[model samples]
Target: MDDQDILMVSEAQIAESFDADGLMLKPLTLFIKTEHPDVIERELSVLGFFSISTSTTPEKTPMYEFTLSPLNT
Candidate 1:
């Protein structure tokens, strides 16, 4: 099949979330949980907030990009 005939589906880009001073998401989550378990619980209670607040479309299943390799004669 020609290159144009190949079909590919890819995942949406995930953004890096940070605190006001630029603390990374993981670190921030850990820090918050350590000091305030309630905060983490509250955050989790509001499901889908991360993607929703960031305007990201949730991925139900993993998607991949399809590549076409040329057949050798």
Candidate 2:
């Protein structure tokens, strides 16, 4: 791994790695566009990470704070 190199991985790579087992990705905080936080939880679970906790936000806004686990190597 290169030092100080953090790649914003494409969704394709994330999915491929899910099946193919490529280099690992660090945990991420994705700000999903939605009023509902549950969707982020579900999506992250599908993406192979557990949701730690969500920050408080107004229901009308689409941005949700989701902390997920590191990607599986």
Candidate that scores best on TM-score: 2
Which candidate achieves the best lDDT against the true structure? 2
Worst 10 residues of 1 by lDDT: 64-73
State the TM-score for model 1: 0.21
lDDT of 1 by residue, 13-64 (tens): 1123344563334311211112333444455446533321111124432222
Q: Which stretches of candidate 1 lie over 4 Å from their true place?
A: 1-33, 48-73
Per-residue lDDT of model 2, residues 1-73, tens digit only = 2223122335864564344554445544545555556655766577655435566446564556665555442
TM-score of each: 0.21, 0.42
Give each model's whole-structure lDDT. Answer: 0.28, 0.51
